[model samples]
Target chain A: MTQQNPQYKKVVEYIMSEIENGSLKEGSRLPSEKELCEMFSLSRQTIRHATGELEKNRVITRVKGSGTYVGDQSRPRRKPRYRSVAVMLTYVNSYIFPPVLQGISNTLNNKGYSVSVSFTNNDIEREKRTLEQILSSDKVDALIAEPSKSALPNPNMNYYRMLEKRGIPVLFINSSYPKLDMPCIRLDDEGIGYEAVKYLISQGHRDIAAVFHCEDLQGIRRYAGFDRALRENGIVLDPEKVIWLDTAGVSDLDPLMDYITKRISTATAVFAYNDEVACQLIRGFNRKGIRVPDDISVIGVDDAEAARTAEPPLTTFPHPKAELGIMAAQKIIEQIENPLMKRDHLFLPEIIVRDSVKNLNKEEK
Target chain B: MTQQNPQYKKVVEYIMSEIENGSLKEGSRLPSEKELCEMFSLSRQTIRHATGELEKNRVITRVKGSGTYVGDQSRPRRKPRYRSVAVMLTYVNSYIFPPVLQGISNTLNNKGYSVSVSFTNNDIEREKRTLEQILSSDKVDALIAEPSKSALPNPNMNYYRMLEKRGIPVLFINSSYPKLDMPCIRLDDEGIGYEAVKYLISQGHRDIAAVFHCEDLQGIRRYAGFDRALRENGIVLDPEKVIWLDTAGVSDLDPLMDYITKRISTATAVFAYNDEVACQLIRGFNRKGIRVPDDISVIGVDDAEAARTAEPPLTTFPHPKAELGIMAAQKIIEQIENPLMKRDHLFLPEIIVRDSVKNLNKEEK
Candidate 1:
């Protein structure tokens, strides 16, 4: 029995040798189980056992109607030597994510690593589940997450801490848990806010409303920046001019629009947190027969493609989005390649001036 | 030596068995390797060997600062079983791909299989490389592809035949190769074209200009549909009205816009092949001070999200997007679970009305 088991191992090794030597090209049918039985002079069960091992290793594909063929076998045979990296985000369907993914994919692919993407749909439970899955799978080498607004006080934070304790690197983008030691790739929310307001102020607008979706850290920083910019320019912050829209637990835009309409009369120029809000507001204004720039000047953050193409064209803060992607990928790669490296990396945002904002004085001239 | 190996295996096996049996939960740290070696009365090398196997299988994660802990073992212990489904497309970052991916993700997630994504980037060499990768990897049990617009003399068609001969299931989505016997998720391009024109005509349109981007199967179908709709309504198809914008070897919208402008007159209504083209037209029209619907009503196909958010909002055909994802996923899952299943599936498209098109009577009133 001892000799028999070793003999089966030898047979399996022989087949692998043939495959490795290029004698068995992909899609080339393998010898039948009966033929293998005859050639190896072994019991059918033993040959089956040997073939089963080959199948488990993904060295061959077994089709019932057809015969087994040599598998691609091109995927690196060397097991991943580094810790796994996990990227958690809300959605993968927009322009924002593809470039991020492209940057990550290109970097990771070059480093001979594989990346797995998981979507949270902004659900706390799903986010928790996804993190748990990543930690448990041990498949992820590192983590690049855009956390749900409810991350703090959420149990998932504990789990994230656990990963940290285990020496797994976790990075946040467009979101942050500042208390956590993990590094983040965040937009200059404060800068964007300041820039939008400064531009409006420079255009000789005394009354400006900054509209923002509030829920997380980014929102807080942006609101702070807006306040700072207004104060720096000696414009007293009007509580009414600061409109905070509740995006928490709200996914639709109708109620938000209603709120904006009630507040629109007081401000001559409006600044929005992101392009989506800017576009929505523009649509709402158009519905009211209020022409953009001519009736009310507007500016928005995030130089998303929508901003540039919206009716009057949106004037937006040109965020270095691709750079953000590159930075995150680079950070993760650096951490992976040099586990001892420790430094917090921050990237700057660029302002892209488009047509959405109405320069009231310029238009009059 | 055999006894020592088995003894070391037993120690590691005991810990793993606790994990598998739920006695040890994920994130729970384990005993030191030295402790384990001592407990098994085996050398450190044997203990290391066994623990290494456990780690490779993703059953545990070892951290530098922290000790080893139980890893996510929720994924099936076996390597993912091979399936017949493959997705071949140009650039994974395009606007149309996400909804399709969401559909595929939801459908396939419901089933027990994983889908492999491959990108061709519109290059024939990359497309061929992707195919070679897919075929050799033995990862895809079947295929769903939107072949490159320029992949002619049908090199891909023959590859599909090769997969078919090997009894692998194949399906096509968004685009089709009619000569191939594969299931396809296709839009009723003819109906969409006819409907777009018919809607414009119903709004009291007379002089109409149609713009097409390319001469691929999709472009051909849309053009034919436009012509058929015009002919059915007893409007003479003016060769001049059908302007084929040279999109070949071009990726930008500026040249196309210039071409349209030079040929444009007082055409009351304009129909475009897709929302992207419609958006470019809106921008071009804005530059020329030509009012939409007030001067020329515009209709587009593929009611992507951007369509609804475009300046005036675009009226378009809702491609069978979600269904395409579901069908592709279902087809792949079926092929994976039951390798004997045959291919050939088709879907339908629906119209979504929005604000981009203006009613001439409404304007008159």
Candidate 2:
């Protein structure tokens, strides 16, 4: 018991005793890496590797920006215990939050881990500040964040980097900053765009207009998909029919309405970035006495719950939003428990058709 | 210097020295009430009174179940500095999380304190467990929670009582359990229900159906309001038209759908419990080939984002979900900074009209 794996045994025994004595406690952060390295008189890398093994054993978790912590292994060893995890998003009062949260909640809850949530309001400053606070506070054991648009400068990359350096686990959902070392859970936005446009094309709509909120990496990918579909279908991308709104600068609908009205001449069918933006477009079009599908067909991404109840319904691409949340939570947990585990997850999006798009053949000639 | 008010002067000097010497960090949990009493060799009640004065002076915050912590005061006085404060929630991915969060963030940020959040996924066990974790972690200075309905069945009431006994401040949102001695930030659910029904009557609807999701104090109030509206209008409540879905037990939509489809009749209008339930009902009706507003008018409570984008566009009661978050955060902060300050807040709900509810006059006879 003391010879071959003495160092390993010592670290394991220390954590186990803490758990048994209820000293480390569940959802509590362990000592810093520097402190552990010093206490063990071992190299920082060696200390981390040992901690990594413990993490893989599900005895502890490393929250990014936050330190490692004892995992939720309350019972005597049997199966790997699911450790506590947290998710941070910009807004939760949308159709997307419940399902996505449900996905994460159900998955973590089943694994015997609790999930905590935070909202950033899509403000980069707020997002960075909240992340820093979470990290410094050492409250959560792991984090899954839907990062603000990559195009929008987030001044908090250093904090995220610090978490990575500490071997804490973090996963990005919906969008991720490419250069970051963190894993991400996202849909094939370009593929979704291509599928959506192809669906509309199959319905015999030649002239399609696409509307998107700009300055977001996700929005750009979606636009790329829309462009690719049009290109593959032998339709040139018409600059006039594409409406791009600077959502980061102005979060109002007036400019968006004016942009859509101007494109009414050449666009008989429209593809929107997301359900919220699509709904706004519909409301604007309706105000001008325009009818959906009959006058102009509209499509959106994110088969949000609102899409189903929107006037005439919204035909759009459905992504595994909640599934993404679940996967992200699972992945971050994996990273926390198994520091050597390195994998990327890509979720696929589905196209859901309803009344928002019209069949050209049904229209009166 | 230690003349007339020797005890008060000594306490003030001790706190100031700790602050200036950087021994008391911002967000750090203060010494326990019993420990402070012992250190000062004073009665526990005297220590409590002194702490109360400090709290009023914005020197510290008492988070129930957590501990007393340095307040978010940026004063250059001869004292230690605290960095920020945070408020936690159970979930943020709903129609209600945003505005309330916005209000909290705005208020807290303006006051130079940072706000952090956490969610418990509505599990009472998790809620209780997380509270303990958050308390020991010493993360935020204060907390504002909309406790789960199941909290009543557990020892959480006693736990919170102990917290209050120790001088920590907590504020409940949306749901109030009188057994807990805490302030609550809620909405006039009954008034909202009555107003929603009154609006439908004004629109010339008679045979209106009311669909409610069961359990919870808020739901009860909303139902009472709905019944009051019908009673005032001399419209008898039809048991057949009142569809109640046990949302507490069943988290999925299948049961809700089954309940809605089985009870839907020749009612001209339907009043749903909330936006989430209303959207589901509309989707169920659409699946059955029934056109909303044309076949049956529908109204929902909670002007959730989904309601605005539902297929026919839901008409709903506009409850300030975000405003509730903000008010709850503010009240909790106030309580934390001033233990003697006691107050309760309740917000009002409004009506937002869209396409889901149709005017009877617009129907073709």
Candidate 3:
């Protein structure tokens, strides 16, 4: 084991002493394996073994594709003044949020800002409570938020206005409440909807059915774009062809699946609000003996893992989940540095074609 | 609309004035809808309309099966000194974390304590950084943590020790580090494993294969229990039939599925670490033209949503997800109130038999 190896112990002790002596500061890049090998006159394997031990001991962090950095415990014992950022999101564990959060955490951590996270579970009441706590905590220096039910008129507007009045820089992500007038970093959700439908049209699919989540502004905007796409194509917007499901409806998809099947029975293609819905629809169709891209073609937004792993692999618009988060962190920090900073970033829609969308033009030709 | 109705407005105005004058406190439960009708001499329909408006306006919250409570903005403008709690978990969004967080947040919010959450993504480095932040923040009164990679030797133990030395109460949820000597509220994972295997054996499955997550103490303990059950049944524990997967293996299961399939080829039943693994195996089997329960039986722990929704619904051991979080919050509060208090809690397992397990005795007869 590396623990028992004399040469590895020497390397570990050298790094430990450097960290203790303030020669190697927290977050600073450590010597590369090649350089370490040269310095210690040891094999590359020994260097790796020592570094691995250091990483496990929390003395260094090895970021993939990035060099190793001096890890935790190097901070000065005396309390240092550092700006803290508060991030509140609808959800933080699964799907897109994980990468988004990873991006935000990484960016902010690199900038030496302490980041604290809170989850609202997409509930307005939880959002209200979280806001109230943030307002009173006196710890947070800035805020990055994904508004709860942004499409709905939020009663928590006063709390946000209060935050503004207090001169706290708050940047919105994914979705922003209209009443807030805050700077936001999000994907071009409407463009995503427009592009997805246009791609379906390119594939010669007309009678396109749509399923939209109606709670957040992103979903609402996407629906708006979907409507515009149909109108531009001189296609009548059939009310029956469009299905609106809220967060609750989305969570328990079993009862909704029957409704969805009935709604899309006459359609040759479907545009789902997200990969989750798209995957679920595909699964539901499988059970009913309907094959994806064979019986009915489907497309979705957000190139989630489900989209890639779904039976037929969905052709979907990619949501810049992590990139958006990184930009949000950078923008929020800039806003913090300069209170006058006012900027909004919108990631353009990019379609990742897989097997879900069928080419009706091939049959026509 | 409720806004235009005079009777609804009257009920709203009454509640608003009561809140403004401090008659109704934050978190204080409101009278039931029936009582409100009696008080206002309004119809039940009108009362419902009024309360719905109140809920939307953030003046009140209506928890299902629970009474409505006075909502945000009821607190005095002057910052009241409230004891704050910090929650650190492995993941906060998907699977079991949502309900667990809900329980913790609800309990803490009800007690007028401020709660801040952080995610570690089950990484020791993130845990170290988060703990360092918590230590430096000096805001947290107590901490409720789910230790990251609890089965492995953790390097962040010193930070936890520092928190203890600072007289800040820390209670662990899900899993606790063995070296910490900290109080934890978690499911009896070992018993769950033993019970799941016993249930499978009761259904007459002799050749059993097991897949275990080896990163956390819960998984390790569960493995121990599984081994005991096999030994008790006089069945030789086949190393080839046992697969020990880490967090990375759990995340990207495609490559591992082949190995798993080959390992469990001779086994009549398989016990997965959790519902996720079980559902993945079922899906993997489906692709290989293998049917669940009909071809091979499967059992898993954590009655996650996927368990219920999996093709053939899974037979799983129930995890006290939210209840554990609630108990953790409650215990941490108790510890905060009395620093000398030290208690540990373990939730016993119960199996939810769905369609996944098949009784071989029926075929034998």
At residue B330, candidate 1 shows an lDDT of 75
Q: What is the DockQ of each candidate?
A: 0.01, 0.01, 0.01
Residue pairs in candidate 3 whose N, alpha carbon or C atoms collide under 3 angstroms: A93-B93
Q: Least accurate stretch of 10 residues (summed lDDT) in model 3 chain B? A: B72-81
DockQ of candidate 2 relative to the true structure: 0.01
lDDT of 2 by residue, A61-87 (tens): 777786777773443432333366768
Candidate 1: regions farther than 4 A off: A1-83, A150-152, A248-251, A363-365, B1-365
Q: Residues B88-182, candidate 3, lDDT per residue (tens digit)?
A: 98882259898999999999899888899999888766787899999898898889998887754455789998998987879998889876767
- Reference contacts recovered by each candidate, as fractions? 0.00, 0.00, 0.00
Q: Ranking under TM-score, best-scoring first?
A: 3, 2, 1
TM-score of 1: 0.39
Per-residue accuracy of model 1 over B1-365 as CA lDDT, tens digit each: 01122555576658766865789897888889889878877888988887787776566777889788887434433232463356777652266888887898777766655667778765444666777777677666677777664212234567767777765667677666655645566677667787788888888886788776442456656766776677678775544455543233123455346445655565888898788788778878888888776777788887767788887888888776777788778766654444323345444465677776777766677
lDDT of 1 by residue, A261-314 (tens): 655577888887677778778888888787787778888776778787888898
Q: Write the per-residue lDDT of candidate 3 for residues A235-321, one digit (tens) a residue.
A: 765655666655655554565575568767889999998888888899989888998999999998888898889999999988888
For candidate 1, the docking band is incorrect
- TM-score against truth, every candidate: 0.39, 0.40, 0.41
Off by over 4 Å in 2: A1-82, A248-251, A361-365, B1-365
